[model samples]
Target: MERKQFLRTLGTGAAFALTFPCLQGCSKDSDNGDIEEIPSGVDFTIDLNSSEGAKLADNGSFILKNLIVVVKDLNGNFVAASQVCSHESYDQVRFTTNDGGIFYCDVHGSRFDLDGAPLNQVDSTPAKQLKIFNTELDGQILRVFE
Candidate 1:
């Protein structure tokens, strides 16, 4: 190959290599049933009178728009939290069937309290607290917001 052509090809390859990683990191965070962006002061309500909404009870939880998980505390109060697992950003958190009032992440065995606080002995390192939202139950309607 000619010296000039080889130098040009090498320069192009180096440029591509340097640009690839930055492009990959620029993608937005994503997951199944996830909301792309949550605006400030978001407030929404779930109708318990509906068929699927009727399934929730005290000490249980329901996933909202697949983004937030709403937990009904043992005292019959409602609480909300981001369903995404902080350690690895998984969205499979659910209430354990026991009386522990905890949300269990199926991905890595992380436990979070109904109030979205990280529980002790989290299996993953650099454990992160779940993002909690304010919740209020008004008759058959449960409102959740950040």
Candidate 2:
């Protein structure tokens, strides 16, 4: 083939190669429906002396257990909420010191207050409230329950 014809064929083949994978990735059938659900019947405890419990010793610190995000608020209060984000049901929620200690999902910018209420609109719609579990501290053990 001539140089000009070879160059045209190579460019077209390269363009098709790059675009095909992206187009395939955009198909709805490729979605695995992997959205997570808020945990239920979640009764569990953490020992203050254990390594996992030590994470919550500091104010504004948090730990994830049983699909739950347990946090020590800035005021030193223990609170527990589901790690599942209300928007898109992704398990990416965590407590952050930002906005005075709120649960934030990095996946879609979904924010929830300590009370599990949505803080802002996500995806142009009001996101649902996160599941908030009750927390009780007795001696050196913290109990989290639905």
Candidate 3:
């Protein structure tokens, strides 16, 4: 599947590994989802909050829409992850660091890197990477593809 479509289906830490095609060996930081063709046409960009009328606070969260997306890590390295958890499939949590400092899972004890590599996990739990979508920023508009 393509990146953008993966985002809607997978969660943050469960995307990367589960999505990469022709991957070498599977590990904790990645998933083993099967390879299927991403639909021919799908628009993954959801303006969670438009920057036009909304004010992006210097230290607050302000998005135009609620359709979550995978933005650039604080370091600007690009990686799109599903906001849900592959382990739990819950959509009520997230991992955010304005400074790109850490990936914190609110529901579970999972924490990962900016690249979704695991930093820690619960005992014997199956590790999964978030589903990632490929993206492009057009001026101020982000064009996400699956």
Q: How high is the CA lDDT of each candidate model?
A: 0.68, 0.89, 0.49
Best candidate, TM-score: 2
Candidate 3 has a TM-score of 0.50
Error of 2 at 100 (Å): 0.8
What would the per-residue lDDT of candidate 3 be over residues 2-46, giving only the tens digit for each residue?
887787666754766566642544442354222333223435553
Q: Residue 95 CA error for candidate 2 (Å)?
A: 0.6
For candidate 3, the lDDT comes to: 0.49
What local lDDT does model 2 show for residue 15?
99
RMSD (Cα, Å) of model 2: 6.7
Ranked candidates, highest TM-score first: 2, 1, 3
Positional deviation of residue 59's Cα in model 1 after best superposition, in angstroms: 3.9
Model 2 TM: 0.75
User: Against the true structure, whose lDDT is highest?
Assistant: 2
Q: Model 2 over residues 17-36: C-alpha lDDT tens digits?
A: 99888888777445533468
Instruction: Give the lowest summed-lDDT range of ten residues in model 2.
Output: 26-35
